[model samples]
Target: MRSFFRGVFVIFFLMTASNWASASIGCGDFLRDIASPPDTIEFVGCESEPTKQGAPLTALYRVKGKDALAAELYLDKKMGVTERMKFVCCVWEVRGETFYKDKKTGLGYHIRMGSEETIHNKREEWSKIGYFYITVVHLREPL
Candidate 1:
């Protein structure tokens, strides 16, 4: 009986471990290292809010930085991770745009290389990197 119980325990452990390993981590983990330069990202937090039909809407990170940078990440239900990233490039309406695509490495990035816009104009960009939905917004700092 002891040996049989030990066998069952081992099987349970393996099953649980495998499932945990296969599970995709939340978006916050993907954004942990990301930073919008001049302001360092110190914390990456995640939460799920109640939505319609009892379904939870996950806001991977709703940042409220203290003397730092704050931002939000939003997902488009109609777009896959890669498709959403492609859309980001088209929406970037900077005066001078530099876009880079790397099919071999599956990495894409762009830089808004143009004249600065007026402070009142909202500057926002969205993209996906890996499993992360990234949003970069330039806004007037709140007093």
Candidate 2:
């Protein structure tokens, strides 16, 4: 019985580890790294309160890279702030690559993509690199 239990424990551990290894950020993981205060970086998404009745809404994400360098991505939407919610953008670093993905859209858009340099100094190198904004639209009913 003891040997059987040990085998079960080992299998459980391997399954958990494998699950973690398979997770990938569709857009990238840059935003994830920035959401935590303790993190060396930070990302925030903001949208203006709807003003005009029919005016298109816009969502903006501000990614503050290390050393205070910052970049912004904007998305236009048709939902109100109450019906739709935006979470802190996430950034992830993997294999020397920096990736940015919208928390809401998951892998739907690639707001920013770069090598190690872009992640370290986004403010200065964003234009030179391929920094772009990703917008995601949801069709959930209003709360």
Candidate 3:
């Protein structure tokens, strides 16, 4: 009787623990990718528009609390081209990572990520260190 009860208890604990663990990882949340700044939090979707100066196409994220654009992206006139992105909020320590690749088209999203320390730390804030553009350029050098 004791052994059976103990096994049942273990199984129940395992089930509950798994649900809690999954919720904490932020895997259910998605990051917003380019035509926007690197500092923008990853979300399920991001919108785009031509900027006021009218050069690079900008990717923008609407931050709920701030009610403003969190990041901006500069895109080429043509599709699937290289980009320059500026981060506006709560992102520091950026690095480029190749998240996807295509065998046929040879196009992929080379993305920037914040360091673990910075990513987890600055959740609800804005960017601007020394009042300069926190920009990342995604371009491959000449082959």
List ranges where model 3 is wrong by over 4 Å: 1-91, 102-104, 113-121, 126-142
Off by over 4 Å in 2: 1-30, 33-38, 48-106, 113-143
> Clashing residue pairs in candidate 2, if any?
29-91, 29-92, 30-90, 30-91, 30-92, 31-90, 31-91, 32-90, 32-91
Please say which candidate is ahead in lDDT: 1 or 2: 2
Q: Please, what are the lDDT tens digits per residue for candidate 3 over residues 1-143?
A: 22222222232222222122111111111223323324433343322222322111112122222221233222232123233322323333222322233333342322332221122233344332212122121122211
Candidate 3: Cα lDDT at 115: 20
**Per-residue error (Å), model 3, residue 91:** 5.3
Q: What range of 10 consecutive residues in model 1 has the weakest lDDT sum? A: 134-143
Q: Which one is best on TM-score?
A: 3
Number of clashes recorded per candidate: 0, 9, 9
RMSD of each: 19.6, 18.7, 20.3
Candidate 3: Cα lDDT at 38: 45
Using all chains and alpha carbons, the TM-scores for the candidates as numbered come to 0.21, 0.20, 0.22
